[model samples]
Target: MSSASAQPANEPDNVFRDPAFRHFWFARLCTTIGYQILTVAVGWQMYALTNDAFMLGMVGLVQFLPSIVLLLMSGHVADRFDRRIIVRTCQMVEALIAVAMAVASFSGWITSEYIFLFVALLGGTRAFETPTLQALLPSVVTPRQLPRAVALASSATQAAIIIGPALGGFAYVAGPGVVYTISAVLFSIAALMVFTLKLRQAPQRLTAPVSVKTLFAGFAYIRSNPVLLGAISLDLFAVLLGGATALLPIYAKDILHTGPWGLGLLRSSPAIGALVTALWLARNPLNRRVGRVMFGAVAIFGVATMVFGISTWLPLSMAALVVLGASDMISVVVRSTLVQLDTPDDMRGRVGAVNSVFIGASNQLGEFESGVTAALLGPVGAVLLGGFGTLCVVAAWMKLFPMLTNRDQLHDHSAHGSGKAATAR
Candidate 1:
């Protein structure tokens, strides 16, 4: 699956022109939709079962725990193994989990306790699949088209996020079993699409022997590069502080006084905003002042979160979420471009794993934090506090990581032998 070998003779400028990327993109969309649906159904079911914010938080925590424990090993494996095989296997496992859950739901055997166990399984699959998929992306398209490819991928994900929850909400009218079954079918289709991809995975990196240092190479690489460290940390803390997703269920039920369908709409609003932004970026890619834009977008995200937190009007809250998503999309595109372009081919898997961990922590762990805070200070107070905290983070990040703030171009960095070079590796 070498790029040279897989590249079509008549390739066009657009990433969508690449057949391999088309299949990969479709695969990603299906899987993302399945995961989003599963998330909504599970979250709603957990809340209904226990009526406890903490338990809903626990759902996120359980899924994230496995990734934390296996983070280093997963990166190592992604670097060493055939990433396609790894991804395909994980998708199969996820499909099985979905099927099992569907059967359990139909049989009235599904419970909050078993759901935790199932979610843990999902987490384990994610631990390996995320890095492998991240590393695999570059293999699908040429380096010149990487930015557009990333944008397209982001758009696909946002589209799935927009559709999945709404579909899940409607499906729920029948039963959770139906939602789970649909998810399983989508996962199966995603797996098949992955199987069809023609990627040229890089040869496994074997420069160093297996050791603690080698296992944790991704962390070391990120830590040594102030720019990369700041970029990653900014996203880590900003999203952790600003994330309002975990509280959405509470908002849908208590605050907005909406039913399951309304909950679906609430969840989908951010994705709608994000999808539009992604499409815009795909056409007009960022070329300058990348760092400043990222910071500005994050600020906007925080403000939107605060607005959503206080608004009693459903339309206002939804609109705020739309802005939040749009702002976050800018940050995502900038950060992802910085990360992928900065790292060498050999280290993409490891660094990608580290990035995935940061993302999972910001999202999953943030959910847990929201739940705990909600229990203590009520959902409204918790969201408002998070929004304020996000603004403070932006101020701190600008000062602490002057290199990031000073960066002007996304693809102009020379990978310093250490990781801070002003040009791509």
Candidate 2:
């Protein structure tokens, strides 16, 4: 089917204004906030147990390594099943994991090893859930509303990132156990909300038997498509080099001379900035010069990272982080819209899974990079050098993928035969 043909005529005129979308959006927001709480709680607890930066990296490693291993299989599963059910199942698993952690923490049985195990389980569930969620978005609204939906999703996530850490920090001061318990409760609520959503399923294709060859097709697609490869690489390099979140505890305790509350603010500053920009973009979508905007935003992100690295004042550092967040959000929306528009529906699951791996790698690998660099060069030097490194990557990518740089408008040309790409200039 042609991209235009994919638009369901029965779709409500006010799809973007649909109540179901709002419920879905709120569920995602709640889950993200809970995830943030768990992240901070685990990191703080791990540091208190073992002061090694490498161990901090280990936390991220455990979460992402399994994701890398299982992503292709996860994609296959999503393609063959109901996405909503997949999402609900994964959320339920996540809720159980949260409950386990809460029990461990509250009962004084929580340990670094237990946390690692919990993170690993969470990663496995995410391997299945992430692709399903991404693939489900187009089903929730018409193609014309996708840009708005994407913006709303991004803003909601950033909002969670903004509030989660602050709430986690406060909860931590009261007790780590309390934070874990609260996260569990929130996760349960999110799962319940997801259960209440009424999404129409897309028609499935009858395909040839699945095999290892089919499994690797997603990787082959990514390797062969310049645009997809370029976008993923851009994200990986920028985030891997510029990610400073992993080292926030060090700065909070040793550098900034701040309490848990201040640490929360510092951690959340970027997301707050991102949320502001995302909300604006939601109101006024970026319909032109997307390529230039993406590149410029990423460059600005690098610059902000550099500034944040050197700033001793809390307010200046927070301001720098805000800029970084805003810049990152711009890149996020541009790349995501491009990817979704370019991908074929039959291949959405596998392609989205591959994208998830890139995201996982960028975040977890970035955490590892930050921890190791901080250990080797001290926090200031590590962050400053990382910012410079990100700039270098962006410059190189811009040179290598000139097509991405010069692209004047989004197109839906398929690079594969699975089906027609579902958007156009």
Indicate which candidate wins on TM-score.
1
Q: State how far residue 161 of model 1 sits from its true place (Å).
A: 1.5
What is the Å distance of residue 328 in model 2 from its true position? Answer: 0.3
Query: In candidate 2, what are the lDDT values of residues 165-250, reduced to their tens digit?
Result: 87998899977888888888887887887788776446353174688866766677666667777888899899999988777878
- All candidates: TM-score: 0.87, 0.87
What are the candidates' C-alpha RMSDs?
4.2, 4.1
Off-target runs (Cα >4 Å) in candidate 2 are 1-16, 44-56, 105-111, 172-177, 200-206, 247-262, 374-378, 411-425
Find the candidate with the highest lDDT and give its number: 1
Cα RMSD of predicted structure 1 = 4.2
User: What lDDT score is found at residue 337 in candidate 1?
Assistant: 78
Model 2 per-residue lDDT at 374: 93
Residue 200 displacement in candidate 1 (angstroms): 6.0
